[model samples]
Target: MPESLNRELLEVSAQVRGLLQDLQNLGFDEVPLAPPTAGLPRCGTAGRADGGEPGVSCRPESLEEIRADLENSPCCDLCRERGNLVFGVGDPHARLVLIGEAPGREEDETGEPFVGEAGRLLDRILSAMGLSREEVYLCNVLKCRPPGNRDPRPEEVAACRPFLERQLAAIAPEVIVTLGKCAAQALLQETTAVGELRGHWHEYRSIPVMPTYHPAYLLRNPASKREVWEDMKGVMKRLRGGGSR
Candidate 1:
């Protein structure tokens, strides 16, 4: 990375660390959720990849406890190395869960899921269908950043599969919206183009899985946005008690 970019990243990491500390020290009342910036990444700030602050680790006995444990636990390599673990976000009982391929720079930094440029577009897309970030769960196949932002290797995906599975089992969402071919293939254990995987629903251990284009891909290939819309419509229709489109 260029010196300027590296400096900017370091600065962003410091801010995120400070913000997290404030949240822990003060309380929720000290800060409130704000509207996301237009066109900017939804995930706020980045942090040191070497794990900024020391996090607590304790095993939970129940699903809710597991969720909390995941949040607090820093046992995972990513969690221990990165200042934060990019856990899934949204209502615990959300009717929909949106899964992505992996965490990008924004997500890895802030320890939040779906907060990059793609995430911003995804929020808009969901809003168009009468949903918001809080209405559904958002996560990724892998919790860490792959070197050079390249595609996740099979080993990396396998290593993270258990965690993702646990998260899914905990949420027990009615529907799952898988972004990109990677997530679709990983969750469904199939090898098919996103186009072929979309427009219909598949079953993942009895949960509904709907594949669609990753927002990042759509960013580079705007033409695919139309197909994404079609896939999202299918998700919304199902959410509304209608048959999958």
Candidate 2:
């Protein structure tokens, strides 16, 4: 065989093996012989299976370790003095975890993530996906609101990373859906455009991460709702059938 053809064959073989491994991990008896090669990326484990970042770090050995980090870390003053921490809400055993950028005007007032207009819309979206507020964990990259609803700064994200890490440690969700560009970037530690990142499954701290349009953005750009719906459908399929690699 030609060298180039042999290389191509090797690559394809690796991909097939990877897909099979992913399906097996998802508890599926069998997977498609070929890759989807379409709409969304295949579902599987994170590229970084160790649950640690290249430069960034995470230390979550036990629930007590997570709790001590939260209590001792002087990360976000807002979380410290706020009416409520709004760390997160949902069933700890939830299969889906929704993470947004930060609290908004109404969310800040209520000290609960995803309770604003965007949140109400998110509830509807969850319903469309056959999930309810009680079934999924809801949180944000930052527990507190940024001034004037502006994007969260890098420093702010770093400050709150420990808290988010601890929450994920405690919940140990199967999948994480990042709501917007900011949340996606913070979780993935990348500056990639949201459009380029959506419709694919990326990994963050060893969890399958799905980037979707934020409800707030969907409220402004209704045209994009169709795309979001498609992504949600993929999520629903994964939830229903366990998952496919």
Each candidate structure's TM-score, on Cα atoms with residue i matched to residue i, is 0.70, 0.69
Worst 10 residues of 2 by lDDT: 40-49
lDDT (10s digit) by residue, model 2, range 23-128: 8999999655753334432211222213434433323244444445565665766656555455677787788889999887777787678997888899999998
lDDT of 2: 0.77
- Residue range 1-245, candidate 1, lDDT tens digits: 89999999999999998888888787654566775434431111121111323342222223455556566764445555554567678887789999999887888889888888889999999899999999888989887776557898887777677667767766778999899988998889898998898878898987788898899999999998998888888888888899755
Pick out the ten consecutive residues of candidate 1 with the lowest summed lDDT.
41-50
What lDDT does the true structure give each of the candidates?
0.77, 0.77
Model 2: residue 80 alpha-carbon error in angstroms: 5.5
Task: Report how far residue 225 has shifted in candidate 2, in Å.
Answer: 0.8
Model 2 Cα shift for residue 201 (angstroms): 1.3
